[model samples]
Target: AALAQGRQPLLLERTAGLGGRARSLFARDVDSMIDNGQHVLAASYHETRRLLRRLGQENAIHFQQPLSIHFRFNQRRNFPFRAWRLPAPLHFLLPLLFGAPLSRSDRRYLFRWGRRFRQTVPEQLKPLTVRQWLDEAGQSPLLEQLLWEPLTLATLNTPLRQASAFLLYQVLQKAFLSSAATSGLGLATRLLGEIFARPAEQFIRQQG
Candidate 1:
């Protein structure tokens, strides 16, 4: 953003690379590139997308359409959850209601949970953990195990018992209820260095 505003911003990195935690390694033996960790982005990451666009590397990230998630419980059982091309909330809500691998009772519980989330104010959530919030909101055990637990762990990198309710609530609002496009999943098609770090370095040098 500073670069876009005609300000020469100096970026200082102690590491040899620019990507920090999100970087890749090139193996000379196999001539293959490997990421340090898998980094997935949601369309709700507006600032990230904007920065990529500023670096002219938007196409380096490949985005999935319609926000589909495939969950494999077993070799024989796979559940696919796909969002509709509808408006905000409905796009995600309809899928949870009808298409997700949830039982009728689970769906009802989820609906009630959604209602409670909608009514909740951010300030009221600071003192609670995600597990406590879910229990208070009457989240079904099945739904918590199958969906919320995994999602919470993936998003917060913390167990529901330890994760903050307010943090999870903000993520839910952005990914599920913001807009149809906000839930789209983005994967970097190129190496992390090529996609972001190298381009950013070049941009900075050019500016300097």
Candidate 2:
């Protein structure tokens, strides 16, 4: 960003490696490269995707067309959630309303929160945690167990009782409500170091 703005940015790294915790290590025991964690990406990350394209590493990450997720509840039962290729909100809304494993009454709770999500400001949600917000919104226990709870953990890496409602709202808005394409999941096809860190460092040094 600094370079794009005609500014020379000085990078200060405390460790020898770039990408911080998003780096990869060669595991001789496993005989393969392994990332520190499963660093998943959302297609909503437009700027990051653009950067990958600029670096000619666009193929390093693979994205789904539209959005789809399969939740395995048990050994036999599996729930598939797929968003249509429609516009923003409708893509996910159709699946949530008709296909989700929720009772009709429980699905109705979406209307209230849907309105609130559109109307409420960040300041109004700042004091509440995700659990509190869901409770106040009359979200059923089943809905929380199946959808919101898992989503909160995956996106924020925090428990629903501790995660900020405002943050959760922001993530949902950007990743799901913005556009159908944005809701898709993206996974790196290569090692983190090769896909991002090394290429990024090389690009930066060459520019400097």
lDDT, each prediction: 0.80, 0.83
Off by over 4 Å in 2: 13-16, 26-31
Instruction: Give the lDDT of residue 114 in candidate 1.
Output: 62
Q: Could you say which candidate leads in TM-score? A: 2
Tens digits of per-residue lDDT for model 2, 1-208: 8878778888876667787767887779999889867766788888889989988888999987677888888898678999898876778777887888788787777755666677777788999999999888888888898789888877776889999999999889998888897898888898878888898888888878
Candidate 1 residue-wise lDDT, 1-208, digit = tens = 6876889786777776678756777768878887756677777878889889989999989877767778777898777888888987778778888876788888887677667767779989999999998888778776787678877876676789999999988888997677777787788898888888888888888877
What lDDT score goes with residue 14 in model 2?
A: 69
Error of 2 at 199 (Å): 1.0
Off by over 4 Å in 1: 4-16, 26-32, 153-162
